[model samples]
Target: MSEAMRKPETNGAPPVISVRGIDMVFLKKAPGVLDGLARRAGLPRPEPVGVHALDGVDLDVMKGEVVGLVGESGCGKSTLGRVIAGILDPTAGTFRFHGREMSEMSPQERYRAKVAVQMIFQDPFASLNPRKRVIDIIGEAPVVHGIVPKAEISDYVDEIMLKCGIDPAFKQRFPHQFSGGQRQRIGIARALAVKPQFLVCDESVAALDVSIQAQVINLFMDLRRDFDLTYLFISHDLGVVEHIADRVVIMYLGRVVETAPTAELYANPRHPYTQALLANMPRISTEKQAFGQIKGEIPSPLNPPSGCHFHPRCPFAFDRCVAERPRLITKAPGIAAACHLLEEAAR
Candidate 1:
């Protein structure tokens, strides 16, 4: 990717997706009949508790840019993607697409915005309707969105399947008949059928074999070139993220800890958490070294550790780290991290 395209500010174009202070909280339990009756009867109800899925997260994806969102499992990577894809609304935040705030959009504008951002899930088979044929699964959306005329849906679906590397002959087959990799391709095709400008690929290839993962990753690059698509690729695979992402965002316990250009981050990680993640990533080396691991378990989001979420595991944790949360400060032209060490070094 060209520098101009990677950084939208150079061209003065708004990011394809701009998120600020995004927070997603899910209720621990659904309300039952008694809870509802209590509310209706004006009786005292127990306090509602929530899982902090995302907390004060911020991000930006320039047009046609692929940003890798990497974190350990249950670290809010998928939750952040779902919010960006419009599948789940954040409890608090400002989400903008092409300079328009989603919250401020009129009904028609919101509908169009929703259609423009699509998500491809990790479980291809589960995401697809088991009984629906490939054609219906991929064709129905474009028809409903008026992207294609109902009469031309078949031809459109065929064209899409072929573009996604699936055979047009299998359009009538149900998802169950296809292999895992093929089912993932069908999911890709269905997302593309809607003519979306952005896609949130939440562990899109994690279920596939290593060989199949390569094919899917290449397909994503091809589609980006062919369709002018921007992506928020969420995954825990550091190797895969390094290969495909132009920039990387690191998350831990529902907070963004570091973000920088991919090469810069890999070559010179700033935050201790980011450094630990990269240190543990498996890489082939002639001089053997034991695979390192970050100390301590990740704190629960429900009751996250005070101040820096990674302080308990961070090797460089200090009094300041335990008492005060560090702000994401700019260390270089394109690098930012939330760590007290950087602040101390500057001081």
Candidate 2:
């Protein structure tokens, strides 16, 4: 295996989540409005376009490690997270938990895998049901999953609530009753109730204010230590990922472009897309900064460019980049990038 594909140093243990050749393609919905417009114009109905969300993605996240997946809004980071969290099945891929492929697992084993992995969604308020009280929201899963007895559900909810820094006294209150941060805490409590080993945190702190973001980030770190939990921290915020991630993976236009140890990736990005992303990131410097935007708006997923998906936006794109897809080439130990420039440099 290439260094980037190798599982983290875990004393011979297999990766907690290993997905290979993952591809998520969503068919475009033909809205009623579109059909009405077509009829009014006397044109044929439009064919459904396939929105390629993920393209041949491979990733290995080890036990007790934080892997930060950073990309632009529509670059499939969220989709990849959801795939790992078992929310959405990919169009093509092999999902392997530990050493066992998900396809080979029996029903009982599949259920156990589902319980072992959990997802914290981007919108806390939208994720929580308005009709359910806080206690029911957090306690229901555990009771149904047999993690806790129905009679002890309330006390069990209270324990997790305290651990997540949410006040259990407000158990009877609705989701709208708490602040954004508290709602997020409730979401965390719900995920923890199942005693999950891995968490797919999709923009978990993005909605919070700066101060509240810090609190939530710290809470994640504390929880990791306390519970020995592994995390797939998906976010668009480079700064936040730099602070909390051990390794960072950068994706663009439905493809993973670069990955490396957090400090090294930040200090010396190999791919042009990674360089552009880091250059535009807001920095705390007294010196004046010149933020250079990546050229062109991100291409639509409905008709992604041929060859390398990022070729249109990459500053270093050559004729070969326009004609041939680049596989990730190992740049240095623990670092790899998918770029034709690196391949040319090797020759």
Q: Which candidate leads the pack in TM-score?
A: 1
Candidate 1 — what's its lDDT? 0.91
- Cα lDDT tens digits, model 2, 232-276, are 999999999998898999998789999999999999999998999
RMSD in angstroms between candidate 2 and the native structure over all alpha carbons: 5.3
RMSD of each: 2.5, 5.3
Clashing residue pairs found in predicted model 1: none
Off by over 4 Å in 2: 1-9, 29-48
In candidate 1, residue 276 scores what lDDT? 89
User: Residue 221 lDDT in model 2?
Assistant: 86
Score every model by TM-score. Answer: 0.93, 0.92
Error of 1 at 295 (Å): 1.4
lDDT of 2: 0.91
In model 2, the Cα lDDT at residue 296 comes to 86
Candidate 1, residue 23: CA error in Å? 1.2
